[model samples]
Target: MAAVDDQTPRAQLTASPDGRVTIPAPLRRAAGIEPGRRLVAYVEDGRVVLEEWEHLLRRVQRRVIAATSGHSGSAADALIADRRAEAAHEDVSADATLAGRGAHGPDPA
Candidate 1:
């Protein structure tokens, strides 16, 4: 809290002996961090940052959508199609292996 950086918002906070810090209610409300929300903590540039997991996911989703929008297909759809193709390849390979084994006895070992 303590205005860790001028670029970030300031909040008054306290850390207990067990190394747990409580984010004040006002700060939480301002940041839209609600109760029962999941979070991730990380250190960057020698600063600790706590962020809601949903927020991170949304930001990444936006980035992905923006990155893929120029393409003629949806990212999720493309991913599903790719996975299906991979599975089909695996099925073909397995069938070929089984057929080969049936057509020819085990190789001399």
Candidate 2:
């Protein structure tokens, strides 16, 4: 449970006849929303949370940093490359083993 902090930003929204709400320009700008941009919405803590995909990714990234204690630096790319190389090597080795076995499969004598 989080304590109530009145410092939270608030805004009023109005829905049209078809239940479509028009987000005020100021709020939309603050949230990085642009014209014709798509928003992702979900229910969290009994409230609707909406934001652009990039913004949501940034929020999750921030949490990851805190959880990892700043250890999630730029090593992801290198790690992925290393794993792919290992998989490719295993594939080549398997193919070579299969070819070698076929040559000595059986002596037809």
Candidate 3:
């Protein structure tokens, strides 16, 4: 076991042949994993990995909410509205340029 730093507690552990590994208390606390909590495991790059349930989805939702919470509408609705407005603006500009070319028949030069 090794402590990476004094302030930020971290440790390294090895897995046993029986597939049992001990999780350090500080690391468990930081990861929000508690006793009796359920976890998901999957194989990646020939290595077995374990992660908390709903971990990925929850993390993405947290980031989205944090980024858009201050907007006028709800986070999800605001994102949709902003995207629609951008698309509409692009369409209007495109139509205006097309109309201008048709009316003026290109540059005088």
Candidate 4:
């Protein structure tokens, strides 16, 4: 086991020739990674990052399914629809107010 200091950036250890790298207990505990935990590895800025793979994939798949089924619309679409309805209501109210303006006499103090 490698000794990691407080300032150590999660020691970058190499896998054995057999393609196996033991995860440091401290790092695993901090990341909530444990035995039977699935992980995804990717390189960013020349360094490899390991993340909880199954959880991320499940979240992405759920979003994709929702979008494909049209059960969930994007935030922008919902906002635009709401704004359009509000504008339509405002226009109707303005038209009504203008048409009734002459019927109401000058504002009585």
Worst 10 residues of 4 by lDDT: 96-105
Candidate 2 TM-score versus the reference:
0.40
- Model 3 poorest ten-residue lDDT run: 99-108
- Candidate order (TM-score): 1, 4, 2, 3
Error of 3 at 77 (Å): 23
TM-score of each: 0.47, 0.40, 0.38, 0.41
lDDT of each: 0.61, 0.58, 0.61, 0.60
Q: lDDT score, residue 74, model 3?
A: 73
| lDDT against true structure, model 1 | 0.61
Superposition TM-score, candidate 4 onto the true structure: 0.41
Encode model 2's per-residue lDDT on 1-109: one tens digit a residue: 5675675445888765554566777767766778766455656899866656545555555554455563455788556555655565565455445544543245345
lDDT of candidate 1 over 72-109, digit per residue (tens): 77778779655655565565455444544543344445
* Local lDDT at 70 for model 3: 71
Tens-place lDDT digits, model 4, residues 1-109: 3576686547577876655567788778777887866555656789666756556455555554455455366888767655655565565455445534532245455
| Candidate 3, position 4, lDDT | 54
Superposition error at 19 for model 4 (Å): 3.2
Q: Number of the top candidate by TM-score? A: 1
For candidate 3, the per-residue lDDT at 24 reads 93
lDDT of 3 at 45: 81
Off by over 4 Å in 2: 1-10, 57-109
